[model samples]
Target: MTASSEARETALLAAQAAADKLATDVAIVDVSERLAITDAFVLASAPNERQVQAIVDEVEERLRQHGVKPVRREGVAESRWVLLDFVDVVVHVQHAEERAYYALERLWKDCPTIPFVDRAAPQGDAAAPGTATLSADDIDPASADPTPLAPAPGDGATAGGGPLQDEDPSAPEAAGR
Candidate 1:
């Protein structure tokens, strides 16, 4: 059998969210013929632990819009690799090193790949070719002890990255000025 339309839709949305958050090599693998559980798996790679968390958060939020929730999540603490089990679609967002080491793609290489399209970015121009436009959600604002956000290496941005996440977007804060 093949992945149902619902499963495919979820996988695609997950992939798009991952891409929006600067995840790399995002792809969907249909594992229905080999697995009895999920219909497809969405795989993505982040350069660092922070980006890993960011991608995961985006995936969860975007999927939630469709009224879907992950049944289970693992490896969130380490942030080297994270898994989101959304029943029909399982998403794997991994760090660069972990992605190369685990190589889940090789295991499911036989499965046909489902195309991923990021609606927010046309022509695959989500960010500059080599730069990532970090978002406020990149850092966990709800952490027990929140840490400052540092721009990822090679992003060509300062430590502040973009607009202050805490600042109100509607009106510019003139306190510093």
Candidate 2:
């Protein structure tokens, strides 16, 4: 079975909140068929613990604004990885290191993914069509962009906010000019 529309909507909202906090590698997995506990998973990462916490906070606050609160929260102390369990949708905000090491996407590779686009980001920061979901193997952590979610033109592709192309004027790299 697929995720309920409600779960997908919540997961997308959580993803947008993470993007607002400059989270990277944002993705949503439909785990309803694989897992009975939750319908979907929203995964995102930051370069550091502080940013991870920031992303988590933003996700929580945004979901809360919609009158939805997490039924449980985990791993907030170290900020290496924080999980917000909203029942239908679970948000995972991790440090880049932890994200690369644990590779949650790989663990749930068999599941389908949900596409996300940052509407507030410049057109060039949007992801390419039909390439939203990426596995750990698909990413080279060392080469991954460490900059904020607003991807620079020459940096690389991002989950929701990254340079669309170097030639695009709307690319973040050109925003400075």
Candidate 3:
């Protein structure tokens, strides 16, 4: 049994909203087969407490725009992990530390992941083919924001937004530019 259409839509919307706030590793898990309370879960990670709060706020705002509101919320005070339960769907915005420690993906490994399309990334452009796309792990927490997180690594695109040339001189984009 998979998530219903309505549940999937809500989950995807929350996932996109989290991504809009620069949340990382956005994933949607179909928990309908396991849980009766909710149909799906949207999991995302933030670099810190403030970012966690930001992601949560954005997720809530975006969902509300869709005429949906969280039926329950948890872990907002510390901002380490915030769970927004919309009944049909649940959004978990966790700080990097909490995400690593909890590893929600591992726990839900048995369940199939629902496809998530990040509206932030252009359509048909999952990423530049052949270019190593950056992930949250590649980001330098202090140097990622504001700076465009694109192009080859070491090309001043730090996760936290810092200017540092890639050490590799062999890579065509960074080394030649």
Residue 88 C-alpha lDDT in model 2: 98
* TM-score of model number 2: 0.70
Question: In model 1, where do residues sit more than 4 Å from their true spots?
Answer: 120-177
* Model 2 per-residue lDDT tens digits across residues 1-177: 899999999999999999888788899999999999999999999999889988988999999999999999999999999999999999999999989999999999999999887655555535453235566998976578665455655555654553454358676765765
Candidate order by TM-score, decreasing, is 3, 2, 1
lDDT per prediction?
0.86, 0.86, 0.84
1-119 per-residue lDDT for model 3 (tens digits) = 88999999889889888888888888999999999999998999988899999999999999899999988999999999999999989899999888899999999999999988676
- What's the TM-score of every candidate structure? 0.69, 0.70, 0.71
Q: Summarize candidate 1's per-residue lDDT along 24-117 as a digit string, tens digits.
A: 8888999999999989999999999999999999999999998999999999999999999999999999999999999999989999988775
Q: How close is candidate 3 to the true structure, as a TM-score?
A: 0.71
What is the Cα-based lDDT of residue 107 in candidate 2? 97
| Native RMSD of candidate 3 (Å) | 11.2
Write down the lDDT that model 2 would get. Answer: 0.86
- The C-alpha local distance difference test score for the whole of candidate 1 amounts to 0.86
